[model samples]
Target: MSRELEALMLDHGADGVSFDTIVAAGANSAIPHHRPTDAVLATGDFVKIDSARWSRLPLGHDPHVRSRPGRRLATGDL
Candidate 1:
């Protein structure tokens, strides 16, 4: 999702980028919060996304993944 985040940063006229896109899969979910690994994506679990952006102005960009109750996506077969 780095691409998406980069796009977002650019959209808000950010001057520089700080981190890579963090994407985690499968049991990595049990990691509480994790980053993307070389592992592939499968079916039967959930994907958690946590993103952040800091700026001088209130860009009104707030990530709300887990906050949206009941949103589901298959991550891997446990």
Candidate 2:
């Protein structure tokens, strides 16, 4: 599903993006962006999303560039 979605987004022209395609269950749901383990969901479990989509000009280009004066958030802290 993620591959298909990515292909679709690219085909439609997405400049930049980030994602967390978690498939968690049981206690894992509470772990946030949890990778599946041997644990299983019993009766009630849910998935979480910490995903984002962005558009920016590629380096040395004018398409994905940001035209602002604010400080860019450092990776992992954004």
Candidate 3:
């Protein structure tokens, strides 16, 4: 799911992902900055998704180039 989100970002004109996508589920979600794994999501588990993308621009032209902000969503919000 994380990989798919990253692909979608690229499809929407993002130059590349700013970092590895995070898709932490269940107890793993308790950890900050957890990396995605092949573990299957289970019932009652909370899922968190974090992603960031960078857009192409000339060097020193984009102030946010080196500081792309990331957005996060959690199942708890749903």
Candidate 4:
């Protein structure tokens, strides 16, 4: 899912991800900074995504222009 999100960011014109994405699901969501794994999502589980991307602008052009988007998901919706 992190890979997909990274691809989506790139598709949207981002230069690249600023850092490794964080995708925590189910009990893993309780972890402060859980890294993404191959764990399958299940009903009643909670998911969290924390990611940031660099702008398409050239490096050093604008150090302050980063894109950080975060979201939480509940598998129950699936």
Model 3 ranges with Cα > 4 A deviation: 57-78
**Which candidate gets the maximum lDDT versus the true structure?**
4
Runs in model 2 with CA error above 4 Å? 1-12, 36-43, 57-78
Better of 1 and 2 by TM-score: 1
| Candidate 2 lDDT | 0.45
Ranking 2 against 3 by lDDT, winner: 3
Error of 4 at 41 (Å): 0.4
Expressed as tens digits, the lDDT of each residue in 1-78 for candidate 2 is 334544555576665445634445545556755664555445544444333444666578755532222111221221
Better of 3 and 4 by lDDT: 4
- Candidate 1: tens digits of C-alpha lDDT, residues 1-78: 547766876596654444444555567766644766666666665765544443443456543212112223565455
Per-residue alpha-carbon lDDT of candidate 4 for residues 7-70, written as tens digits (9 for 90 to 100): 9998988877889889999889888799767789889899899999887455867654787888
lDDT to native, each model: 0.52, 0.45, 0.74, 0.85
lDDT of 2 at 72: 15
Q: Candidate 3 at residue 42, lDDT? A: 72
Q: Candidate 1: where are CA atoms >4 Å away?
A: 12-21, 58-78
Lowest-sum lDDT 10-residue window in model 3? 63-72
TM-score attained by model 3: 0.70
